[model samples]
Structure formats: C-alpha cells, structure tokens
Target: MTTPRRFDGRRALVTGGSRGIGEGIARRLAAEGAHVIVAGRSLGPAQEVAGEIGGSAVQMDISDAEATMAAVAALGPLDVLVNNAGFDDFAYFTDTAPQQWRALLGTNLEGMFACTHAALPAMQQAGYGRILNIGSEAGRIGSKGNAVYATTKAGIIGFSKSIARENARYGITCNTLAVGPIDTPLTDAARAVPVHGEKMVQAMKDGTLLRRLGTTEEVGAAAAFLCAEEASFVTAECLGVSGGMGISA
Candidate 1:
C-alpha cells in the first residue's frame, strides 16, 4: 500500500497564515507537499510561521486592492488560494459606528474580492484553481450581537456562489466553510470580555450537539479536503465545520 500525495507539485497561497486556523491550514498544505505562500499585514509573525512551516512569506494587507493585486500578481500562478484573512467586530447593529462597519467590510468582504479577482486571471489561463473562503456560522444563523460580522460572512457565501457560477467553465471552484467557535487567539480575546465572555464558552459548548468547541486542526482538515483534487467537482457550496450548530439552517 502507498500513501496518497494529495498536493504534490501544487502551489498554494494562504492569507492570515500566521496563526490559528490559517496557520493550521498552511502547515497541513505544506505537509501534503504544496509549496505554500503565506500573506499577512504583519511581517514578523508571518515570517515566524513561514519559517516554522518551511514556506515562504509575503506581507500585504488584503483589504487594500492595489496591494492585494500586486502581491497576487507577484506570486504568478497558484493552484489553491485560501482566503482566511478576516476580522470580526461583534456588536449590536446599533452599537456599530460607521467607521467600524466600513473597516469590517473593507477587511472581510472587499479584501476577499480583491484577492479572488487577482487570482482569477492566472487560474483561468491555467485551466484549474481552488478557492476556499473562511466564513462563520454567524452568517448561517444571524447572531444577535454579531450583525456586522454576520453580514460580511453572508456576503462571502454570496460572493463564492457567484464565483462558482462564473468560473466553473474555466475549471475554477469557489467555496465557503462557515466555521463554528474554534479555540483561537481571536476567541481568547473575546473570552476576556466581562459581559458575554464566560457565557460564550458555555453557550458554545451547550449550543452544539457535540458539547465542545471545534479546534484549529479540525478546521485545517476540512480546508485541506476542500482544496484537494477530490473536491474538484464541488463548488458554490457553503460547508459548515460547526459541530452541528449550523444544522438549524
């Protein structure tokens, strides 16, 4: 018996690969033999992760169109692009300021659009590509205090579907993985808040059928599968890694 080489000779670009789910995905891809390139707004952390994973690093703010395009162009052709760079501002819609909303949309929605647009030309020319967007379960079922965050994730689903419809003919597939509460640096910060902090952990555990939160490694596995050759036929789909929490939708 022989082990499978899932991504041998493949090239991948993973945004926000410095830590958490993104780091897990980048590490997995590199382990599977993909030449991975990690991009982030910060260089130091990105470099550290890249060094650890034996991958290359590039510093670019995905929210900036020009920067994203330029960075993607420099990467030349890519077999897989993991749009994992995202931020969340959790608040009631009324509490969110104009600037905050703009910033959220800029980083979450516009940033993804720019990277996808920039990667399309090369993918189309090559006749194959895989694009995986990291979304959230908040989008699947609207969150009370996460209105803005939900909106952006919902936007990702729509954008991915549109990409699938338009690019399937070019051998390109786009999909969104709406993740549940995973143990990550971001979540740690959220847990520090006094109001809904402890409640969050309890709710996440009690709300899910699994009675536990998901992990970065689990999400990484799902991501690797989505970007694998086996998933070539799957597109325009929103897959939930949400421990059955998203089953309500």
Candidate 2:
C-alpha cells in the first residue's frame, strides 16, 4: 500500500505568511499537498509569496480582532491554522510605553486569540484541525531589551496549551514552536544599523548551541510536521526549533 501524504486534501491558513518564517511555513505546507492561504497586512507581499507557491492570498492585519474574525469566518473549515503573525518591540521594560505595550500584546496575544477563537467552530465541526503558533526562544529564556516581546511569546505557549487541553477530544492539536534566531528580513533590517545591529547578531550567534543562526527551511520542516495528520497525537506541547539555545517554557 502507498503511504498517505501527510496533508493530502488539507486546507491550511498561515498568518503573516508573506515573508520570513511564516512564508517558509506556507510553502512547506503547500509542498506537502495542502492548499495554503497566505494572510498578511499587505496584499502585495502576501500575493507574491502565494503566487510563488501556488497558494491563495488574503490581506489582513492580525492585530485587528474584527479583521481576524472576519478572515476566519470567510475561510470556513480549515485543516490547519498557523498563528505566525506577531509583533515585537525591542525595548527595556522601563522604556516601553503603555501604548506600545497594548499594540504589541494586541498583535501577539490578542490577535492570536481572535483567530483561534474564530477558527474553533469550523475545526470542531470538521473534527480535525492542526494549530501551530510561532513562538520564540526569548519567550522561554528571556532576553535583554525585549521584555515585552519575550512576554508576548511566552503568553503564546500558555495559550496554546490551554487550547490543546480543551480541544483534545475534538481531534484538534494546538502546539507552539519556539524558534531561535534566523537570518530573515527582520534581522537584516535590525543589523543594518551600526552598534545595535552588530551586538544583536553577535549575541544571537553566541547564544545558539550551533554557533550559527537557524534557517527558514529548518523552521518550515518543523511546522510542516506539526501540521501533518501524523502529528494528531502531539498536542499541548512546546517544541523548540532552536539550535539547543534556550530550551524552556
């Protein structure tokens, strides 16, 4: 007998899938035979990524609760939902403004909640769903100049566990992947500066067990497996895609 395709006939929605890790995950899912829907704040970038992968694209800001809900409703039943959209502000806790905190948390935690809440009904009705949240190593071990970012990522782990426990009976799996540093546009932009950029890059490399940053392909592989049918038994767990760096939370 032929082996089953991990995600054959499946439909997946990946938020912030226009670029970076999100885009990588989207492409990986599609390669595994799932119909991927890429969503992001901008249509141009999202559509470009989708076109490259032969997937569909939808412009949305996950930070907006109403927009997230509407997008979920419009997508209907989904076999997989990757909550990869998130926001971060590299600031000391003392320097973080109240408004910035709200914005950061809104996109990272609240936005995730809205999307997951909206997707629940469809998943419950369908009786099969995979939910993967893109978290960070900083969430697990904490980091300097990124207190809010760390907290928000940490929140995702807790939130995902709760959802997993509640939905286990419904054949729904919710898990978070705590990713380490990777070479991406985000990092590139940060490093474009002088002192701060250099420091960030060196610190990332030093913190990693591999002494090198992670790759988009590596993260994509992990995401693909989590969203696969074979991973049904895996839920309420935090998987570290980090190169043996920070490994808790």
Candidate 3:
C-alpha cells in the first residue's frame, strides 16, 4: 500500500500562508508534493513557514492589486491558487465605519479577485487550474456583529461561482471553501472582544454539531481534497469546511 502524493509536479501559492489556516493549507499541499509558495504581508513569518515546509515565500499585501499581481506574476506559472489571505473584526453595522468596511472588502473580497484575475491567465494558457477561496460560515448564516465581514465572504461565493462558470471550459475550477469558526488568530481576536468573547465561543460550540471549534489542520485536509485531481469535476460550488454549521454558503 502507498499513500497518495496528490499534488506532485504542481505549483501552488497560498496567500496569508505565514500562519494559522493559510499555513496549514500550505503545509498540506507541500506535503502532497506541490511546489508551494507561502505568500503574505509579513515577510519573516512567511519565510519561516516556507522554510519549514520546504517551500518559497513572498511578501504580498493582497489588498493592493498592483503589488499582489506583481508578486503573483513573479511566481511565473501556478497550478493552484488558494486565496486564503483575509482579515476581520467584529462590529455592529451601526458602529461600522466606511473605512472599516472598505478595508474589510479590500482584503476579503478585492484581494481574492485580484489574485484570481492574475493567476487565471496562466492557468488558462495551460488549460489547467485550481482556485480555492476561503470563505466563512458567517456569510451563509450571518454573524451578529460581523456583517461587513459576512458581506465580503458572501461576495466571495458569488464571485467564485461566476468565475467558475466563465473558466470551467478552460479546465479551471473555481470553488469556495466556506469555513466555520476555526481556531485561527483572526477568530481568536474576534472572540476576545470585551463584550462577546465568551458568548461567541459558547455559541460556536453550541451551534456546531462537532461541539468544538475546527482546527487549521481540518481546514487544510478539506481544502486539499478539493484541490486534488479527484475533484476535477467539482466547480461553481461552495464546500463547507464547517462542522455541520450550515448546509451551504
């Protein structure tokens, strides 16, 4: 018996791969024999993770379209692109400032768009690609104080579906990995708020059939499966990595 090395001879790039869920995805793909590039805004962490995983690292702030494209271009050709770079903060809509909303959309939605736009040409030229967008369950069910973040995530599903419809003929499959409350730094920060910290954690545990927050490794495994050769026929779909948190996004 032999374990499958699913991503052998492929090139993969994961944004925000320096830590948390992004790092987990990068590690998983690399483990499966993909030539992984861990990209993010923080150089040190990205480099560290890349080194540990025997991959490459780049400093890219996905919100900046020009810089993000330039960075992606430098990687030459990519077989897999994981738009895992994202940020969030918990706040009621009334308290949400215009700048905060813009920034959230910039990172969560705009960044994914920019990266995909840049990567697709190369993928199209080769007639092959796997683009995965990391989404949130908040987008499907809506979170109380995370409307802005939720909006961007919801936007991701629509964006991915549109892209899938447009590019599937070219053998490019675009999908969204709608996730639940994972134990990432972003989630921890959101849950640490002075007002709803405990409440949020309790709610997540109660709502999830798993009865606990998901792990980065769990996210990685599910995402890896989607990117594998076996899932070629899958496109225009939102696969939930949530622990039975929702039916669909």
On lDDT, the stronger of 1 and 3 is 3
Ranking by TM-score: 3, 1, 2
**Model 3: ten consecutive residues of lowest lDDT:** 240-249
Among all windows of ten consecutive residues in candidate 2, which has the lowest summed lDDT? Answer: 1-10
TM-score of each model, in listed order? 0.96, 0.95, 0.97
User: Candidate 2's C-alpha lDDT?
Assistant: 0.88
Q: At residue 62, give the lDDT of candidate 3.
A: 91
Q: Give the TM-score of candidate 2.
A: 0.95
Q: Residues 187-207, candidate 3: write the lDDT tens digits.
A: 788778898888987797777
The weakest ten consecutive residues by lDDT in model 1 span 1-10
| Leading candidate by lDDT | 3
Assess each prediction's global lDDT (C-alpha) against the native.
0.89, 0.88, 0.90
Residue-level lDDT for 236 in candidate 1: 96
